[model samples]
Structure formats: C-alpha cells, structure tokens
Target: MTASTDLLATFVARYPAQPATAFWRGIEIEQLARAFASDGVGLDLGCGDGILTDILFKRIGVTPRLIGVDIDPLETEAAAAYSFYDRIHTIPAQAIPEPDASIDYVISNSVLEHIPDLEGVIAEVGRLLKPGGRFYFTVPAPGFHRNLRGSILPGVSRERYLADLDKRLAHFHYLSAADWRAMSARHGLALDSATGYLDGKETRRWEHLSRMTGGLLHSLSFGKSRPIEIQRALRIRDLQNRMALPAPVASGIAKMIACPDAPDSDDIQSCLLVTGHRPRD
Candidate 1:
C-alpha cells in the first residue's frame, strides 16, 4: 500500500470507530504537521488525552521535545501512557508552565473552540514561543455553529439553547479565518496561512451524528455512564497498548480526506487550520 493508505490503515487500527468529524480532524493535523513540525522544542497546547499528538507525530515520522498541557488531570493521566510527550503539564492554557520564549513550535488540535478567554490563550501562546516561532492550530470556523443541531430549533430562538449546547459540546467560540489572523497579529504573531477544511455535507453529517450519539449515550447510560459514553464516542478504544507505531512510508492522508479546499472552494464547512508565526525581532 502507498504511504497515505498505510497511514489510514494505522489510523483505522488505532481508532476503529472514532467519530467521523474527530477522526478527520486528527488526519488534517497530520497534514499540517508536514509543514509546521520542527525538530526543536515543541509544545502541544490544550493537549487533551494527547492521543492525537501521539498518532500525529508518529505518522509524520518526527518527535521533537514535545510537552503536553491541559486543564484536566484525568485526561493528562490518560495521556501519560503514550510516551509521545517528553513531559506533561496540567495547567490552564493561559498559564502554561513553560518558560517564556522557550518553545520552538506549538500546535493545538481542535482545541481552540473550547476556550472562552481566547485572547488570553493567544497572548500566552505568544509569550511561550520564541521569536519567529509558529503556532499551528485547527478550530471550528464561524459557520460551525450554524448547522449545529443546537444552533437551530424549529420554533425557539437559537439563543435559548445555545448556552446549554455550548456547555455540552465544550464549544465557546467558532471563529473565522480573519478573526484568527487578527487575534494572532495582536499577540505579535503573523498569519502564515489559513484555509477551511471539511465540506458542508460532511459537516452537517458530523454535527447531526454528534448530537444524535450524545443523546443516545445519555439515554443508554441511564445518564450515569456519560463519561464512558463520551470516551467511546471519541474512539479511545484501547487503554494498555499505547506504544508508538513507526510511521508509514507514505503520506497525503490529510489532503486527500479532510482538506476539502486548497484555497478556492466556496462551500462552508466547520473548521479551519490556522498557522501564525512569531515575528523575529
């Protein structure tokens, strides 16, 4: 099999049934890593569970001095088993434990959407990165919430249920590419590139199934096994075999599957990959 096919096979083996949207998100990050990865120190911001990072770098065939940080100790503990990160920190993204201007590269995978104080996090990213360092991330676009199940109700105003939905989904902001560029610019970072990912058809399916699955899990667990249901939905199938797989010999998994637009597509989906570089003094 080609390298991309091999990567997909490994992904399928690792996460046999991950949610369509999330699985694709990981794949997209793998693609971004091809350009954004550096051999110097790397930090994974909001690195919940660290599963994606573990698989991502392996697929890309490089391992820097990656540190994983998040606010959840439970998830961090789970992440510890993988050995993908040299160290891990449990702290708020805005209060990263790393020294100022020390990290060489920083990456966040599908993490920015959940942070409410987005500016604080952006500022912190700037503080942690060395001059000319880059921060690469993926987040829901402005259109994410539009087709979301909670954002549209037949009779009730979306405002009525939006808060509740955001809480359940851990979604705080779905920003535009322009918004990301502006936010990063304020933090002494320049927009490297920004582009949308995932097409509308897939996005609608993803959102619909996300709510549908969550509703089912709540019902099936007698509303008590919510945690397990969440994990299952996110496709954390194995607990013990956290060993890294050697990267496959081929690539292009992300471009072929997740990236719906190179630069010219007009259909609105839900997510965008944003890269910001810290300007050299």
Candidate 2:
C-alpha cells in the first residue's frame, strides 16, 4: 500500500467511530435530500469512509449515479464497501478524474478547510458542475478552537492556533461567512441561503481544558516522571477545573440572552451553510 493509504488506514483504526465525521455526513445527507429529491447524479468530494454516501443513497432513494473521490486508497477502499455508488474514483483534489460539467450537484462537507489551494478547488467545482448546478458545502469558520490552548483567550494569534493549517492547504481552508460569500460570487456562483452560530469564548476554553487534562493524564500514566510533566499535569488540572466550574451556573443565564437566529446549540462554531448555483444562460 502507498504511504498516503497507510496513514489514513491507521487513522481509521484509531478513531473508527469518528462521531464528528458521522455528524457532518448526516448534515450533508439531510441537506441534499431536501434540495434534490428526484433522481440526479451527485458527487461526494473527499468521501472518507463513504458514510455520507451511504446516507444519501438510503435517504434519497433516487438511485442517482453516485461517484466518490478521495486521495487515500484506503479511504477509497472503505468507500467501495458501499455498493450503492456507481463508481469510486481516487485522485487528488486539484485534479478530479471526471470530465468537466459531469455531475448535477456537488456535496463538499468539511473538506475545503484542509485544502491549501482554495481557489483551485473552487475552480474545479465550477468545472465539475453543469450550468445552474447546485453546490452544497460547509467549511470551518474562523475562531475554531481544538483545545490547543488551556483556555480561549481574547485576541489569540491566528498564526499559532492554525500552525498546521498550512500543511493541509491541499485539503481545507478556514474562512468567515463574508469571505465565503465573496468567494462564491467571484467563481460565478450565487448564494441561496446561509446560517451562522456563536462560538462563545467560554465554551471554547472549556473544550481546550478538557483535552489538555486528558492529554496530561495519559502522559503521566505512561511517560517518564520528568519535572516538566509533573508541573504540566498540575497546571492542566487546575485550568480544567477553573474553566469547567461555572458552566452549569451560567448555562441558564446564557440561554435567556443568546441570539435566537443562531444555529442549534449543538453547533460548535459560527458555521455558514451556503447553497450556491451557477447562473444559466
């Protein structure tokens, strides 16, 4: 197996039940079912494990000619397990295997943030879609915290938080709601609808503290008893407690004043669900 395929296989092995992955897949399937109820071809870009593809097939019942593409052969192999798809293609995001304007609708869920060349991928999406075709996709909004810092402080440097963001440029890109609108407009696409959510600083801090505490606990149990690790363990636990203590007390107060139009409480950040269409002649 190639190195790329091997790495993805290891990832799947470690987190076979990727809850976040399943959540995004369900979201995509629901959106697609509502938009395209009839039989029509669709493409699932970066179709890891084919969970979303399976959901689309079962829910839509359109028997739409499905094509799933991924760079990782292992993921492609996993995707192939879903017999519903008419074909499974493995190729880089910059260069899809299919010809231009080949599909009716394109579903890109949580895939753009990882791509380094955002413009290139957007152009490719344009190429793949028929005139007036719909593109339903979601990207990570700015201010996404993955528990790197012990707490979410005001004015955190974007550079530090997204240090690895550059590495996955080929796979994703982080953009704000306004930025996404401008991008789609530039690419000759019109926005249909959008949604946003609030990612309060407190909630982010709590998540960070939880991860740090978990990591420190694992290291202390397994790693050497270095002085640094000892200090870090104590520090992480303290931060965890400080950030987690007042969540319940403040929950009621937050609800009374929270924005009504904001996305469901379950949403992690200010995500914008955008549906764009290519203008017809």
The numbered model that scores best in TM-score is 1
Write one digit per residue (lDDT tens) for candidate 2, span 65-179.
Answer: 7788787775677678676667888887777888887778887766777666888778788788888788877665654544224324476576643543233223255576678
Our tally of clashes for model 2 stands at 12
Off by over 4 Å in 1: 1-9, 147-164, 219-266
Query: Across residues 192-281, which tens digit of lDDT does each residue of candidate 1 receive?
Result: 887767555555555554555554564466555553456656555444235433334113322344334333244676678888789999
Computed on alpha carbons, the lDDT of every model, listed in order, comes to 0.68, 0.55
As a whole number from 0 to 100, the lDDT of residue 4 in candidate 1 is: 44
Listed per candidate, the RMSD to the true structure in angstroms reads 5.4, 12.0
Model 2 per-residue lDDT at 279: 74
The global Cα lDDT (0 to 1) of model 2 is 0.55
Give the C-alpha miss distance for residue 117 in model 1, angstroms.
1.6
**Candidate 2 Cα outliers beyond 4 Å, as residue runs:** 1-16, 19-39, 56-63, 143-172, 197-269
